[model samples]
Target chain A: MSIKITNGNATDEVAPQFSAERMVEVQRIINQYPEGKHKSALMRILHMAEEDFGGWLSVPTMNYVAGILNIQPIEVYEVATFYTMFNIEKPGKVVLEVCRTGPCMLVGSDNIIDHLKLQLGVEVGGTSADGMFTLKTAECLGACGYGPMLQCGKHYHEHLTTEKVDALLDAFRKEHSTSSNN
Target chain B: MGRKLLLEHVNVPGIETYEVYRKNGGYRSVEKALKTMSPQNVVEEVQASGLRGRGGAGFPTGMKWSFLAKPEGVPRYLLCNADESEPGTFKDRYLMEKIPHLLVEGMITSSYALGCNQAYIYIRGEYMWVLEIVEKAIAEAYANGWLGKNILGSGYDLDLSIAPGGGAYICGEETALIESLEGKRGNPRIKPPFPAVKGLWGCPTVVNNVETIAAVVPIVNDGGAEYAKIGIGKSTGTKLISACGNLVKPGVYELDLGVSVEEFIYSDEWCGGIANGKKLKACVPGGSSVPILPANLVCKTAEGTDRLMTYESLAEGGFASGSMLGSGGFIVFDEDQCIVRNTWNFARFYAHESCGQCSPCREGTGWMEKVLHRLEYGHGNLRDIDLLAEINKKIEGNTICPLGDAAAWPVAAAIRHFREEFEWHVTNPDEAQKRNFGIASAHVPLV
Candidate 1:
């Protein structure tokens, strides 16, 4: 079975809304498709929603996206659940998705996953107690030649050694700490 | 060095920029096709070039274009499939990241050939960084006269955009890509009226791989015959092979399709041989979906003829002793790597990626993964080996899409080439966990 991560029931909460500038950007994205095909912008808008609304899609958040496209709520929910990229449940601030497929495995991705699990003090799909980091194993991210890699947000950290993992965690922790202080 | 049609200017600084790419003779194909040639004339040139799809299936690109049902007064769409999720393949991502303009140029040129007024590059979501690069290139093209309204005074109007897929490997399939583009689940639609007849938004559509579409830039610029002269027969263009797994140099390399497998594996110019001086145990010459070949059979056919890297040559013996050059994902396995473990890993990937549309693929992939996992983790009887083969036979041809066959072939091939290893895992479960089965005796003589 797939991993499910949810923070209690969020259905009763008010649906999140996009900001004015973000709404303009969403309109531009909808315009990319032909007329009456505003549904085509659903995926891009969901990505924006995920980024802006606490890093995961709550029930109310998906409903808000459905309202934006003027589609059925079921349409939004089915699509949100189908793709693995969207997080239905709340996650830590930083989600480290490491590639654990064939080529990466051959190049010692197993050891990297084990090392991450030990360092984070969590299992494969668990987040740390402080809600700082969540560990996840992903399928191929297409950087096969540069194996033993992980993706934190948009950047890919490749050729991972234990030392590189240590430095990465430290850097992320430092950045978070500095930002929170501000 | 082989001639690089698509990546000739890849090393030039700022090739990713439109200014630098335009300075190095980029967008010439768009000019050539739009300014002079008719749409049918462009198709004829591609047919003459003998260019097969660089995507896994080696179908003739020209033939696929010819099948587009051009109904009067209907808009046709061309989608560039940038969903590069095949396990061992990374060439598409590299090409898009390094020289994004080449794909932009190819998209415009090929769109013109198909008389398409709108196009989209459906890239995988994981490569968000690469998507940003291509989006910038597309914006630059729009800024110039290359895109949007009457190009080169040809009265042809084209508008291009990019679509991002939510993380799903099934989205790489063309139908699934179309579904995803329509903001739906990435379940593949049943085919009969292939995409040629009924596609995106119920209009005729043509979807081509990123590499396949990029090849059109060179095919139109220098004429088809010139492009056809580079590689061997049937495989008449340079191919980008992404070499990974236990290689001295593991990255993307473009080679003439007829280069010998031995030369590619051992040559200083190519992979530079196995990493750390380890002997090669086996190789998945194509992507992870294709059959794996034992070391002795990798460089030579069953008949002992040299195995060249062409589609026909790689598939010399029909899976009994041959494998396809699928997507040119050359994955090498060193002597220390474990086959059972690697096979289970791939099976798990398939299980995770399966869209659950077809029962055989949905259930069979999970079953195969479970059985393989059990065997790899040191708990399986001898019957589980045959059980895997049985499941493989059931899933090979029972699905609406090729994902079923793809999931079946590797398991089938691993057992075919390394049955003894599977048996060893069953009999010596504890020892198997301790050490690999080491390169099973000389190639098990072609059955």
Candidate 2:
């Protein structure tokens, strides 16, 4: 019910932008469409920008994407906010999006959501103190049969239990620490 | 056992690779259609097969292809709608993930028939893994000289690619998918200048579901008449159902269209009955957008005839005592499940996914979600039930897309079939807060 807008104002400072390798991929995506219709690649380019900058689409990063696509800045913001996957604000290093739609709820997705809340020590849509994880409820991600599922990054962890959640969190923690160290 | 046309080679090891898929007789449709049959003949085969669109609506696929307006100097496209985000549907995801090349083969065959020099698989962003798999399959198709120029020396050039959608369920609609394909906010366009007339960069286009496109291969290979012989009546060919919810086995199953609803729920071959040996309470036979049917109506139509899985049979009683075969996202509920809560969950989903385009769907979905949330948590009166109905009535058929109707149908059906459940939440507010209104039979025993 709440209207969430990126509003070109996550913070005063924009810390980072896409790397060269990501830029190359962005260029490839832009080139996927015909000339002047590169706007067709906005979603993919925004995805690249999301991964390259942080877990979210900051105003500056979105603007950078607009520049790459040669589209208006508001055009980038409009699309980035329209999609649920594109988080305008910075999310935790690991985002736990648990499905809470009908099929998933019938199969105990609510329990999984409650378990994530307790284990992560964060309420729904809240981030942990260490900024390691963000707990959020998602609509169906087309994994109805594999209900009680959550998507963290590119992977879908289906048929989840409390123990599986703990193991996944532990794995995510390890991955986070390893990446931070690097 | 029903014929497994699309997924026949799904379990074959290395079927993900082009070699294994080809070895297992994949792309036979491509070779057959390209070398033997003309493009018009391929369309005719699909037309004769009586193949319907697999993406919820059940539109006639061949007729839809024939609608394309091929003006001079205009490019026509065939987009594979892989944004399978309906609440209870995941069949396309399973199909694309397990057998990526199946979709690729289907796309090539479809492209040739539609005269689309370039096509796209516009997949949901949430299915990132699936996007990669399909893209890899497309790459393999290119390397094998199937996707790129002069495929198999037939001189039928085609280019195929995967377009990732930023996770919006509304994009699953054809016009919205086209809008998203153009990198917009996925607002469903008003019809009249339909996609066939003007689509994807203002070019004529045809958007088919992943399953519909994949089924083209089988239809082309076996001929449309042979494909038509597989299913009963207007609903022909095998249907892939993504069975889910409280069932013994929650997975995708391919079955002939004429299978009885009872057989599908109880038989070991399909859902294997409700979980924990519980009795069936209700089911959304198709996707979440369809009406929810009570156990009695689901088993037999209003006329006392046995209900079958075919489109006509499932929708035998219209919206009064029937539902649709929308995308075959069959969701089953055991006796322990609460219809009110499930309806609320769906309301929340539609609310979240509503693109805020038309005021009825935009405002109505959110209003319904809020009201249902309150009712489920045990703080509502009987008037709220009627209020929900009123909102649904206003929302249905009042928007640019079917999303309004999709948001309206489940709410309307839940109240239509299970009004007592909502009223029980209102009357027994204290008890409802303590526990869900489980299967009505469990709470209020029959004489």
Candidate 3:
């Protein structure tokens, strides 16, 4: 993962057309409310950046958010960085966040990890050599009862064993039939 | 793993259905309270149970309920706080998502006791799915004749609503929860009326946490004294602890409150032990809002007393050496993790979540986070660390609510326990980067 950060309130030099378009729409989202409180849309701005920048925000994308919010880049970067849902860098096309915290750990997160390593031939944070998925180990996903869980995109696949992990990966492969260049 | 207690009634064959709950001794409390006992008696029963608010502060639930000024002809509201945003805490989320009806049952019983005709559950916005589950449960409740006009022929009426809140840690504060329910900016307000006197739409209100209210059903059902006998002094009944960070067993464990911290961590019943055979370095007994206790102090206080999990035992010497059992968020740390980096993570959270309500919290959290971030990256002087301490002192009680204090405690405590690690961060930069994230995370799954 590559991330570039700057100190000052930076501008969006290499801006995307859609990001700029959505920033204007987000400005209208701000206009819905009274002046001096546009910061209420801070979450929505970060949300837009997440959608616009391929499911994550770069430091530059956060800077663009700050420029649009008419606040310091630090302000936008701060919110972008805090939330667990908001990612600073792009994971692979199939982002697999396996739960590494307690409950899941108790119920065989280790065996599930070994299976993913053997199947994907990469370490936890490393992407598959083919780049089909980038695996990141995360803190608790909060589904303790359904321990040994793995999240494939937005859905949580819980009570996972080595076999269940394989089945989920196979289903993902079937869903994404073709390979592409990044 | 320790067996489930609070989650026992969640999905047991017929738990969701009212008939099933009644068969299991459910709304018998509401019936007993109305026909057999007065509202004051119900209040007294809860008082006798020695149950404290599960929402971080550990305030007395009965005292909070009685503090309500339920004057004649004025409407009273019971706002059930389900905004479980504390990092290590996921107990309330489980209660709301799995057995939405349990909260519904507790709400009706408590609202009846407080003379409140209406109540609301304010949940975190990220858990939008919880709103649907709870709403459907509320519908079931209304259809079953357990809620709304003359409930069970007891001449009592109760209505419940669900309010979703946007992300802001400070909104966990009761006053801020009320402001969010009113569709405002979700900022903390000055507390003089204290919610009991004036809250939610300017009516007499009682804002209890999801755990606090849920505990009520058990208290009233078992009778107050009986419930009080379950746990230790001042910390009665069972508590749902969300253990996280570097621990071996990290899940929600519902244990009687008197269980010692050692029993909770090492007995193989709760968290089991620390992962990777690593030595325990420190622990934040509560959520990040409380001071972090060093491993030595945690094993035994500065005066060399074994640290137990009860309210009094945990906070024996106060902040100088004691830590609070806040929200029961036991975050374990191993020696390998950089204290400065870990502290930076929390400081950043507080600063972003300050709500900009007061200068002390608003600017103070920001400055401390920035200085800590730079200091952690080897760009700070010894003077910067001193400056961070001074800034925290100003933020500690100078805000409208406890948010200010919440922002400062971890920063101060992190330094108190591991000032050398923080200084090492400034003295050396390259070494900090090589350190892995969250000491327990495996680069690969275990085989």
TM-score of chain B, candidates 1 onward in order: 0.97, 0.98, 0.94
Residue-by-residue lDDT tens digits, candidate 2, A1-182: 11111232323476355666766666666666776787888898777777777778887887767666666889989998899999999998889999989898888888898888989899999999999899998889888898789998889999998898889888889988998899
Residues B1-447, candidate 3: write the lDDT tens digits.
Answer: 343445667767767666676677666667777778888888999999988999889999999888899788988999998877765577888778767777888898899889988788887655557766787788888898878789889888887767656555666889888876664556766778778988877778888888888888878888889878877778888888887766777767788776777777777877888878877777788777788887777767678767777778888778877888898877777655556766777787677677786999889999998998787666777888889889989988788988888879888887776777667666655654443433222221111
Candidate 2 lDDT over residue span B1-447, tens digit each: 657999998999999999999999988999999999999999999999999999999999999999999998888999999999998899999999999999999999999999999898999999888899988898999998898889999999998889899889999999999999999999999997999999999899999999999999999998999999987899999999999998999999999999999999999878888889878888898999999998889889999999999999999888898889889999998877888889998998899999998999999999999999889878988889999989988998999999999999999998888887888788877777764346333564211
Q: Order the numbered candidates by lDDT, best leading.
A: 1, 2, 3
Runs in model 2 deviating more than 4 A are A1-17, B435-441, B445-447
Best by DockQ: 1
Worst 10 residues of 3 chain B by lDDT: B438-447
For candidate 1, lDDT tens digit of each residue in A5-31?
122133555767788888877877888
Q: By lDDT, who's the top model here? A: 1
For each of the candidates, what fraction of the native contacts does it recover? 0.90, 0.92, 0.01
The residue ranges of model 1 lying beyond 4 angstroms of the native Cα positions read A1-13, B434-447
Docking quality (DockQ) for each candidate? 0.79, 0.78, 0.06
lDDT of 1 by residue, B59-130 (tens): 999999999999999999999999999999999999999999999999999999999999999999889899
